[model samples]
Target: MGIDDITKKAQEFLGDDKVKDALKSEQAEGVSDKLLDGVADAANKVTGGKFADQIDGARDAADKSVGNE
Candidate 1:
């Protein structure tokens, strides 16, 4: 299959009711968000605030990758 086909399939999975319910039940989104936020914050502090903006973008991309965005 092509990239488009894979993308479509992934979208379908992300939208599935069963999958959605499972994710909600497990609090996957909330947990992941909190965890990512903490990591980003720590990284920013470690870097002396040099990559705060870039870290936000990376965090958003990570969330989207896991169907949280």
Candidate 2:
């Protein structure tokens, strides 16, 4: 299968209700927070803090998507 096909399949799997529910679990919240924080931090460092605000906003949006307030 092509890379695009694999990506589409992965997206479909993640879009499933069961997968969404799993990502919304309380345990997932903690893990998501740590993961998002680390990603944002890494992004900020890579950009030399020039895009810190934007990166943080994007991180918050991603966190909310996983059901975290």
Please give the TM-score that candidate 1 achieves against the real structure.
0.59
| Regions of model 2 farther than 4 Å from truth | none
TM-score of 2: 0.83
Off by over 4 Å in 1: 1-26
Tens digit of lDDT per residue, candidate 1, span 1-69? 999999999999989988877665547777878888999999999999999899999998887655344
Clash count, one per candidate: 0, 0
Local distance difference test, candidate 1: 0.82
With a 3 Å backbone cut-off (N, CA, C), the pairs that clash in candidate 2 are none
Clash pairs for candidate 1: none
Cα shift from native, residue 13, model 2 (Å): 1.1
